[model samples]
Target: MNYRLLWAGAISGLALHLAGLGWDVYRHSRDVTLAQREDVLSLANPSHLMIVAGTAIMAACLLGIAVTWMNERRFGGEGAFGGLLRGAGLPAVGIAAAGSIWLASRADSSGHVHDASHSHGPQQAIVLDLPLARAVGNETAARFVASSGGHTHASAGSFGADAAMGEGSAHHHHAEVPVTAEQLEAAAAFVARLRTAIAPYEDIRRAMADGYLQITQDLPGIAAHFIRLDYRNDGREMDPERPEVLLYTKRLDGTWRLVGAMFLAEGVTEEPPSYFGPLDAWHYHENLCFVGSGVRTVASREQCPGAFTARTPWQLHVWTVPTAGGVFAHDMPEIDPGAFPGAVLPAAQELRAQAR
Candidate 1:
């Protein structure tokens, strides 16, 4: 048996193991969400496979070395007890192999748990006329209070339910009384002022020049969001002239059209103001994971990378363009690429129906 060959194989396997470990670390740091979502710790991961292969090769090489040494000792007139002691290497290898298999099984089981915990279900929207404080049952409110570490709010019960149900659901209470004609007139007047203020942003270049940077790509049924970070935290709540974000959609001809404006409250803890009286229903996002140039809702805090689980500030959308959800809808409707500039887009419900 050539001991030199075994030593060389052992060193090569160690090198591969080290390289794989380093690669795994780098991937986790740079792409944490993707790595976790893809379960990079599993055997299917290239780095994990390399590590396993390297360990197997190194173990085989060591076993071969041990066997060769035992053979040499046995043929050289070694005592039976000495030969038996040397043969312990075989059992040692077997034990190590069993331990490795056990660890691998544990890892696979954990991967299954991770996948189950991160699974997302379809979102359901529930509308209520009563405030969240009164809408939820006493038991639900108690549970919410316990989960929130004794924090209490009129809307906390509803928010807790929303968190459990996952994202894409808006829970807001309409005023008990119907919106009066005067309130509608005032809202229309506010909308007129807002439209005039953002009229210059019809050209997307002007919006970009005015510190509105695009935050999201074009969503299939939703317009892209462009935000001015400074305006978001300026302590201005529902300033028509200084909206926190602008909504835009790309036309079929490649031109960008202004669609709507989003008004954000100054803080997450602050109660959402009814700018348009009962017509405006503000909503916030919780457990949203934000990676570079992307944001998504996760089922659990563990799924959110970088510990970005802070609830978003309450926000309301006011569409200047025609939409089925009206001017002050929580969500924007689907825009038609081939439609004229002032054309009304299909309602969000209509789009969902068409998709189904």
Candidate 2:
């Protein structure tokens, strides 16, 4: 019996399983929540392990063939049957060993599943404390939106007030025109146009590569591959802060066609869904920045607008990313949840086309 094949099969399986195990241990020691764990599992596709099992079984069979190949010439001998049994034994053992290792890899914190995290891609993320995020909640988000809209580090007086009232203060008021039914109708129309634009595109992958790319060509300096997109909307909310439910890519269509209006904000936040997903899951609050009378810099985050222009209302944005890069929740923040719940869709669709 060639033990080399037996050990080789076992070792390969063990290494992969251990890498997964490490990530799992990290999540549990840190208390990754139920919601976070669920999303991670989706990437794992525990069911996908069944595929792994098939490959492992085949590998074991192949080893048996290798060993049996050595014994094929002994076919006429009485020991041939013994040789066959011995040849098949190592691989079978290897397969069983691999299965056990893989099973022990993903351990549900509650002690249900065998693993904790799933494989999405390379992730080097730092998860900020959720409590800190809650501490900054709507106030931070609202300010971020305003700053991105060109309300920079100016005093409350600069925007018209005399006192330096904190952001979104009771005294800080906006002459926000009432959302007229006509404006709402127009928003609805935009959503309808978007649905039509995307529906013919088959799926999210193609749409992100082509459709979104074509529409945003008017905007400059975007790498189709360097970005990813996702969208969500949970209908009207009395407060608009509390989450109602989650969105699904499988059942996404016409229903998302009912957007009202989109608001641009300043800070890049640490929200989910839009703020995260795969490798390119970073959300930047995109607001129109003004340089005197000129407006530019529609795309590309790190790049500044221009040298000759004054970037006053510089579309300030705060980016939110997962603690572990691709490790973000499904119910993450939608780009423009209130307006139409479809802000990220268009951009993502453009990239999806490029991929195709």
Each prediction's Cα RMSD? 16.2, 18.2
In candidate 2, position 18 carries an lDDT of: 59
lDDT scores for all predictions? Answer: 0.56, 0.31
- Tens-place lDDT per residue, model 1, 11-123, is 88888888888987886675433332343246656877778778777877888887888787674357776766677758787688958755764552212111111211222
lDDT of 1 at 117: 14
Clash pairs for candidate 1: none
Which regions of candidate 2 fall more than 4 Å away from where they truly are?
A: 1-54, 66-92, 104-356
How does residue 107 of candidate 1 score in lDDT? 56
TM-scores for all candidates: the values are: 0.44, 0.24
Highest lDDT scorer: 1
Give the Å shift of residue 274 in candidate 2: 24
lDDT of 2 by residue, 1-356 (tens): 55566666656665555555565566445432222223223334433343354446546656665666656655435576766666666667776877665655554322122111111211222222333333223222211121111211221122212334466754644423223344333323433343343343344345335422221211111101111112222232211221121122211222222111121223233332221112122222233233321234433433535332122211112222211101121112221111111222343453556579
